[model samples]
Target: MKKVFLIICCAAALFSCRKLDQPNTREFTEEAYWRDAQDALDALTSCYENMSSDFYYFGNEALSDNAYVAGTGFSSVSLVAGGSYDPSNARVTAEWSYRYGAIRKCNIVLENIDKVPSMDETLKRRIIAEARFIRAYSYFELTDWFGDVPFFTTQISVDESKTISRTAQNTVLDFVLQELSEIRGDLPTNVQYAEKDRGRITRGAAIALSAKVQLKRGVWEEVKNECELLINSTENGTYSLLGTYANLFKVANEFNSEVILDLQYGGGRTFSTQRSFLPQTVALLRSVLVPTQDLVDDYIMLNGKAIREAGSGYNENDPYTNRDPRFEATILHHGSTITDFEGQVQTILTQPGSVPATNSVDDQGASPTGYYFQKHYDPTAPNYNSGLNLPIIRYADVLLMYAEAMNELNNLDADIWNKTVRATRVRAKFTDAGATEFPTGASQPQLREIVRRERRAELAFEGVRAFDIRRWKIADVVLNKPVRGIKVSSGAFNKDPNGYIIVEARRFEDPKHYLWPVPTFERDQNQNLGQNPDWQ
Candidate 1:
């Protein structure tokens, strides 16, 4: 949808106007603006544009165990991960404002779409559905990040905005679920979208996101039901695991069948994930998104057993070998080859005093974890601004969510295993009989760990890990300890047990850190918007 992006760019001024102040005859007014279909389309497109920011794509991973921020500057992520951030952190402020700002845009479209009398009835309904979907997605992010945020369905005056109080998260979720249910019939299925509109929201997208909302609320039965709707229904969209896991992220495979919802980035709009994740050797750019050993260790052996389990064939001395193939696809450890910007193969040497050490450059450019990300790398892109779409939700995530919800709601059966987890393993190229199939009679508890491990492996670095850990209530257990990295000491890779160096320590205080503090600025403006407990 290059045309959509272009329209978004040209209408940037209109999108940024947040105040719905009264319009005068001489000034450009809301009444004057929504005169036709183009106005509705532009307003809706601007909402989509707001969703394409880089923080949602890559920066959120640093908040979790999947990746570590190495730079020494004041990062809101480091502060939040350390449990020291208050409402004053700039990242928290920006995230809160950005999401609400987008919601305001969506609200504008919803309130004015009916004013366009000449617009096609079908197109108007679709536009309204799209606006509702975007608004629901925004509320989901806000409530998920900072619980009990101020909830509003329509644009309000400055006085009303200043007096708005936080709505309970469950109440907000109830409203979101209602919106999704009402609009599902209005949204087109993925297959129904014309070629130029392939990235627009579909019925499957709404259902998948609704299931995610249910999963977050710990409504296991509802999550199972919502996922089964997508899994069983073909009239809306057909989804399956792509043959190769690595190909799922390639630029050439944009909008592939496996993608349920993705932040579209093309038609002169793009992101800097390649620059953020690639090692200096490949892109000659700083590495801000370094994968952690904590995540690396989560990948089970190719034989489908934990590395520490008996007969798993794991070697601590040569730890990188005999690992799940996804480890190679997702991470770039030392001795890995990558195509440079000029198409030459280069080896990444993270060991100390090698031709280029892991800490070769300034602290800003180095990978403190001794590993760089390879999942979103686009070698053919001329530079950092690549047009690769990042998947917000995909079929594999749906399958894993289905499996987890089913195991929680009922017994873990072989049919569920084959349909969900086994299907994912087969896509990852785990063709061995033992690896592709779970042992029969695996208990519910056993299957829970298996599903959690699989989720970590398959969805690493996709910005979902932070939410996964938090919803599982394991953040305190996982985030309280030190984050580990491979050892690069005195010109060689250390193979001893101590080789795993402590990169940094993390913290997650109970109840308080479970949700981010309401921004200090927002609180200052609206006295009713009190800070989250423990932050005060």
Candidate 2:
């Protein structure tokens, strides 16, 4: 199912992004519009277009320990990685602006869908549900990053927007959860949707997204209940693990049972995640989004033991051997073979002193961390700008969420483990007895660590790693160190004790770094939108 949904071609439905201080122009001609079903659809497309940004999708991995942006080209990703971003940082402003922009579009749809006369009652309700889901998701992103944010549901006038103060984060959470729950049943399941509508938000997406929001808040019971609805329900659309984990990301294999929600991209209009992550040997290679050594080391051995564990067959000289299958699927290290931009199998040499600097670790468009990501590779696409849809919420994520909630609630046991973590590992091709079977008698803390690591390994580069680290409260620990790279001599860069290149030094200030400060750009327009702590 090639879901070609978002194209910013509808001018009447669209409003160019602006600082919130500007006049509210979305409603300038909305009464003339929203006059029919086609009009409603046009306006809704605008919501999806604003919601989807390829930058936030891959750039988020760069924000966490999972990946590194090579330079300042991606100021938000790089600066946030360095933990030096202030209220005026580009990301601080962009994230705020982009989210509210999407929300405003969705609000237009929700506020005017009732005027589309002669539309099918079912279709009308479904459209309303979809718009609300998008709005809830936008607010979720806002509260997740900025903590408390100004909340509104209606078309507020320009002057009214200036007087709005930040709502408590808890109040936003309540509305988000209630909205998802109420609208979930109004939307169709993935199986019920027609082929062309494959990428639209489904009932399963509403439920799964709600679970994720609850998980972030550490509401273990609610998270457990919501995730179980999908994981165990027969009436819900079929959502199971794809047997081959790597194929799940290929463009040909998208919209499979594993994907609950994906950012739909096809047709001529597409984004190039591969270009941003691939080496310069491939055409259009940006290579700014390089995998970090810390992420690679977290992949458990095939025997299901951490490499540092006793009797695990990890050797510093040959680090890539016998690691988790996910390691090979997600990371393209030195000497790895990949289908290049020209549709040829090419061996990549990303280490220092490689003959061609463009393909080596030295160039701007090459892997600065000496590792390119294999997960999003789509070499056959035109100019390497792949039309492959990116998974946002997948069934594997729901399983992991189930396991986490179970563990956090002290309810994890053999049965729950088998259904969640073990089931996910099985689908990832983990056949080893140690990996596929539960670690019997493991304490809650031990299970917590296991669940968290499995979640990271399963979902790396899919844009949720930063949220995971933050919610786990371990960002301060994992991010406050040298982001190590491939093993190299001490001349080109500083090396860790293990000869791994220390690519960049980073620090995370606890209490302050937990929530992003509201951007100064927004505050300058509306001082009622107060700032988070410790930001200049």
Candidate 3:
């Protein structure tokens, strides 16, 4: 899978038209390519490979998720941290270059699909559908991130890529919806595909992404209806929640009823380690992503009340109890037990006398964020052998998306009854075993809040929170504050072994920070492509 990173680099290179002078057409149109089933399969896989590429997977995930925080000497942390970013520079360049490369791959498969005449009809259609879905998906991502991007359908000859200007965000989004709507039926439903097809795009994935796109465009009715169709399919045994919250993140529990779509990774030598970038890598003796105070405070109590709410049992100073149980499960801190996959607990002693304190982080790294992330940390795997499959789209997110759309559209139908509100209340009670109460009113905003909170608790640290905040127009309230660090005055702090809590004060970025600038190189190369406002 690490080799996929190189392909992504090639794609990035293609975006700048620098690699055009080389023999570029060979990979897209080799002599024997598009002749057989295996060729079609390989081409399809290549199309999907762009997703797992470092440029798309690591770079995109870090920017979208709060895991990467940019700071001085935090050169590697730019992915999540905002400081390392020049809103008008690096991010914009990467967006155009990577998406253009992805589009190229999609075009390669798409244009050649007809050439694979000997392949099975179903196989051929499926591969073509997957390519179209991915092409649309890539455009959706680009439109969301860059606001507007060139909608390239054909394999851009090096010259065209150099001259293409950004398309309007609306046009790109419309094109995404149109393509997804056209190819939705051709894609496979939620049925378990063959081993080779495990992570490929499915009809359900397309529908889910379409609903998300609709939601982003504020097309509440369409979003609500699309999600309802998927969520309500459970009556026919289509999709249902996994039995337990912990089971959702377990490697053995992957692709359960809860997952709509996921970026699957085999732990073979070829595949790169994704878990290494997550919290377990950091908390379990290596450094990776950390949880911020914003996340810590976002967890509402089990009673469906925010910690700041007057009636909730929240103590701002001793802020652990009476809060949501998920807070403990997802965030590792002073007293949380670090359990291995085999269920053996690793002692993380953060109190005085347990471990000697130091002034600076030495060997055992301190948690960059005061709280540690526990979203997908598998205890069974050895610390160095951490290899948990990351879930990109889960059933819980679909449920929340359904609720948000229904609330936005102000729909009170059976779909809403069966899918979002009732389904979520059941899951909420499942999390808090003693809680018997349910949400009473079904007002749009009320349901929206319920879904938002559910997303916060259920999807925390899968790197979705930051995007959710942006889509919901709540980033200013949630992320625009100076983040606090760990305050372990006398105990061993893992990321900071010396028990020294480093409080690096920061200023919240502005509205323009919401959108990244066109990379300097892209701006320099393409005169028609202008920088995002305030990027210069």
Backbone clashes in model 1? 0
Estimated TM-score for each candidate: 0.92, 0.94, 0.82
lDDT of each: 0.79, 0.82, 0.60
What lDDT is reached at residue 157 by model 2? 66
Candidate achieving higher lDDT, 1 or 3? 1
The residue pairs found clashing in candidate 2 are: none
lDDT of 3 at 122: 81
lDDT value for model 1: 0.79
How many clashes in candidate 2? 0
Clashing pairs in 1: none
RMSD of every candidate to native, in Å, equals 5.3, 5.2, 6.1
- What is the C-alpha lDDT profile of model 2 across 55-114, one tens digit per residue? 889888888999998777555678888987888788777788778777777877887888
Give the residue spans of candidate 2 off by over 4 A. Answer: 1-28, 362-364
Per-residue accuracy of model 3 over 1-536 as CA lDDT, tens digit each: 11112322233221111111111123433555667766666666655655543334433334433444423222233532443467334445555566656667778778767876666888788878888887887888777777876666766554565677788999989999988888876777667466545556777887888888987888888887788778656421267777667778777887687777776544421223334333332333344445555567677776657787777777655768776666776766656666544566654533344443211222245445545556666555654454455667777788888767766766645555456645655664534532324455646676567667777777776757656777777665545444555545543443344343443433336667666666666656556777777767
Stretches of candidate 1 above 4 Å error?
A: 1-12, 15-32, 72-75, 358-364, 488-497
The stretch of ten residues in a row with the least summed lDDT in candidate 2 is: 1-10
Q: Lowest summed-lDDT stretch of 10 residues in model 3?
A: 14-23
Give candidate 3 regions above 4 Å deviation.
1-29, 53-84, 87-92, 234-237, 267-286, 316-318, 340-344, 351-364, 380-387, 412-418, 428-447, 486-502, 506-510
